[model samples]
Target chain A: MLDISVPAKVLFHLGPVPVTNAVVAAYVSTGVLVVIALLIRRSLSSEPGRLQAFMELLFEYIDNQLLQAFGDHTRARKFFPLIMTLLLFIAIANQLSVFPLIFQVLVEDKPLLRLATSDLSQTLTLGLVVVILSHIVALSMAPLKHIGNYFRIGAILAIRSPKDIGNALIEVFLGIMDLIGELSKIISISCRLFGNLFAGDVMVAVIVSLSAFTQFIVPMPFIFLGIFSGFVQALVFSLLSIQFIAGLVNTAAANKEARLNKGKQAALEQPATA
Target chain B: MTLVIRFTHFSTHMEAEAMKFLAAGLCMGLGAIGPALGEGFVAAKAMEAMGRNPSVADKMVPNMIVAMAICESTGIYSLVISLILLFVV
Candidate 1:
């Protein structure tokens, strides 16, 4: 009788594209976030108001934590917006998802804004976007070296003697494993948030449906737990993204991009041209 | 005895249904053990660190929560499997 299955409910379509409740919720939430961000930016000033002061403190705390991971404030600034957006977007989305009205006001007995992140499509999009963004940044920073991270045939080719070929082959094998690791990152990242929120949703459904009288009292504890879990999941998702991006920048695996771009540009470009 | 006959009839009638519930319960129960141990370890470490230096509890708490959530994944997976067994299976 209790169904935890979140079958995608399509409300309507935009000609070719099917628009579900989850998509609509994601759009509305993103719109809400944009407006709030605009309002905050407009109000920010040299002389801070109470709201500005608190907002600034929150930003500073987040920035410092992310910067510590990156170990370079200037470079960290690039990925910081993404971290903040995801943390706040997911936090707010999680809270909105559990709100009573969203589920109560149903089109076909399905909520208009049923937990966006609980939707596989939405979670996968976020996870893939994070992974793609890290690759973009890593490549932009060090194109040749970033490419070298995967198809590390250069190491194999660099073997001077027959004796060294074994070690070079191992390095090449390791590079292939790195490529696989990048793809698995998407599945792992997406499932982590989705599973957590989906479980909470299912649990809530079960508790409420079990009995009329005990429902009100029983669900309150779970709601509190859901709130805490939402914040924790959001934090974990963003922190992981930061750690991944920082790993690329902090490692010798990626060469110094600035030096490569200017002085060693010819040598780096020669292979491509040849 | 009449009592033994009634009990035997109940089990025979509900064998399939009982097994379904049993599997779901077992799946969730056994699956939960790993995460329970993992989270316990995390909490113990967090408590030790907090006790050693009370000043950094702010930093330690969030870190502890994040790690615990990741550790909770095993339990959540068990939850998913059990839910499937309960409802979908």
Candidate 2:
């Protein structure tokens, strides 16, 4: 089994630097999206056929979700393509396990494509990208203030008297805690996704292996359950990503306001001694 | 002396057999109990929710499975231990 494990290798190597499986999956995912887009483009009609109609319904459903969640149609529209791509890739990957024949035929030694979300590296990379994009949007909206968010320099500089030093120290410590919280976001998001999908795969494998008679009949229901579970996990992951990004973009103004209020309080207390 | 040696060897074999059986029973028997309870609770909740809102059962079922999978992790851990005992030991 270990010998049959697919080694997702570095595509290129320069000195000690190496590319990774997640990057390759991203490219594969994009290729799949392009193919689907082309198929839709070719088949599209004002009066839709089955494929076109189905595609339209899916597109609308995802679009409506984005609109509802973000409440900014423009930003939602911009994000929709990426979100749709994720949904499609995850859906297809999850469905791959159902076709045991395809696995036997295509996978000479290893599966042609494992569920991308099952891999920790892929999910973690995607989560990190979402978080980083959120920060980018926040910073673009208020570059100088966002940069100052980490340092709390303005709060420190507001300390006019010796007594305020203790407060400044506390603020700095809180900022460090905030930094750690951001890192935890990546771990939680990735682990939650990887754990669910990988465990489901293992469960199916065990069920099928339990007995020859049970194998033919017993595992069928669980396979159906796996499909449903896969869809939900993908949706939860996307929703959490959207929520994280939305929170980051929306919180910048509130954070700045709170900082200003604190600075004001410190300044007012400073004059009492002087 | 030969009779005494043979008796000691037989006792050791019996002890080893007893340990294997104990390991297998404990690992699988205890492991399955938690997940069975968890899955039942989840199913009950899901059925109740579906009864209340039959229209959205499609959405609810999928969400329930995701929740159930998380709950089922403990069962999987137990299964792993049982397999290790059966195959490795």
Candidate 3:
């Protein structure tokens, strides 16, 4: 029988906490990543082996991506570790879903390991972290300006004459909308990853259960699709994170520049009118 | 002769269950149309750009995929809704 459940099944309890198969799988993947990183670090040398060469290439690719997005070295350098970690972790977690052995290990009749990315909680947490981190970066860059970006109180306060009231009110409304848009960003990103991974799992499960013959080779194409999408999604998620972080800072700086330009123009015009 | 109102619990439950399936199917099927068209348009444009500037294919490829992923978010939203309809509610 094919049983499809949206939520991860709880495998056991630890003290007061319940642990699901997804959590166990996530821990294993994290440990694997940590071990690989440590091994590579300890084996570093001037002359490169195949594994070292591959790791160098991956790091260069990520650096190039960050450079392309930020168009400068400073911000890219600051964000490299966060962006690189996100790319590696997501890619590993996503690709690890296809390991066949994970399906066979059962504890108490429940599968011991399931795809971590297939769980909404896991993806949602990732999305939340990225979005919140961006906000924190923005706040650190320019606190008042970042706060002003979402609340047009400054605009309202700066309205000297009654003639500007209409524009100030409109700016206030748009600010509220921008605040909501940030919340939607969290939902959109997490849901995109979760839906793609879970749908891929469902498709493969359905194909495998179609018939006895399907158990032979029918799932190969579907599995290939899953693998391709996993990589593409990892790339997309990292790229979007870089964009979000850089975009917030860029917009704030641009706004400040524009405001300065406008003030200068007004000062020049007032002297001429006087 | 007296007219009586009938309430068949089993039949109503079955009807509701069938409608849930229909709703999920329709939600996914119709919701996919916009993203499909949008992604097609994006891919076509990206291919055209790559063909014109073959040297920049590397840059264009990643940008194209990112745009397509953003376009696919609406479809993902619907997929989430349909999945909820199917498995949750």
Candidate 4:
């Protein structure tokens, strides 16, 4: 009885682009987020109101978690914006399905609002963005070491004899494996959220069609569960992203250590001269 | 020959559909067993963590959610497989 498919139903075309319901839902959510942000911006004051106080408390809590995860305030501050955006966007997108009247309306036969989190394209894109951002952040700070992590050509080239050749070959193999691991992270992260949310959506669709009389009251609990699952999935997406970002800190730390060693050597030489 | 196939279709279709149905049922039941145990393992460990240090409950809860989501992947995979058998065939 459930008529859902992986390809989000096309609503209309925009100059050759087929705009789907998922895109519409995403845009509407984005609009909601932008309006809320603008209102909050306008209401900014030294004296905090209830909404501002609540927002500040959330920010503080997230920042506290970041500090705990990164173990450094400055590092946490650097990543707070990315992590916070992911959490807010995902949370809103997930909860969009639970709000009534939006998902039921049809435009040319297809419903106008399909949950964005349920779409593979959306989640995969988000996962790819997180991974790419991680690499870009790492690459910006430590270009050579980040490059070496996935392609250890320099290490391989330095092999002098037959004995060292085996070690170099192993390093090359491990480097390739590491690159594959990064790709796998995108698949796993995207699919895990997609699977959970999509399964819930399908289950509800099936349940709603089971009987007309019970439909009104039967789905109430599932709707509540949907809201809870949305919150959890949103948190999971953001937390996994933060973990990926945190993974890069080690290389950055090593880069800093190298610089600090040079600085220490310079300071030692200065003391001797003095 | 065609009428024979068409008239007796339910008998043949029944076996095929039954096998498909059985595959789906088996897929779900077998697939769920591992994740159930793994999730229980996660909860048991989280309980241990809470017992050890109740103050870290907030941290443990989120971490547990993330881990549980990851662990649910196998069950999700099974669900996907079952759905394919039910719908696509």
Most lDDT-accurate candidate? 3
lDDT by residue for model 2 (B1-89), tens: 99999979976777775777778789878978998999999999999989999999987765687567656667655654554465446
The order of the candidates by TM-score, greatest first, is 3, 4, 1, 2
DockQ of each: 0.46, 0.14, 0.71, 0.42
Q: What clash pairs does model 2 have?
A: none
Q: Across residues A1-274, which tens digit of lDDT does each residue of candidate 4 receive?
A: 5787866888889999989888888888888889888998899998988878988987887888788778888988999998898888888888887777777898788898999878888889999999998888888878888888889997789999889998998999999999999998998888877777887888788888888876788888888888888888888888788888778875777786797899999999998999
What is the docking quality class of candidate 4?
Answer: acceptable
By lDDT, the candidates rank as 3, 4, 1, 2
| Candidate 2 CAPRI grade | incorrect
Q: Write the per-residue lDDT of candidate 1 for residues A8-90, one digit (tens) a residue.
A: 57888899999988888888778877887798899888999887787788688789877898777787787778888888899
Per-residue CA lDDT of model 2 for A14-66, tens digit only, reads 68976544354555666766887898899888999888898888888778767
* DockQ of prediction 3: 0.71
Structural similarity of chain A in candidate 2, as TM-score = 0.74
DockQ score of the complex predicted as candidate 1: 0.46
lDDT of 3 by residue, A15-67 (tens): 98999988998898898899989998999999987889998988998899889
Q: Higher-DockQ candidate among 2 and 4?
A: 4
User: How high is the CA lDDT of each candidate model?
Assistant: 0.81, 0.71, 0.87, 0.85
Single out the weakest 10-residue window by summed lDDT for candidate 2 chain A: A1-10
Task: Please tell me the TM-score of chain A for candidate 3.
Answer: 0.87
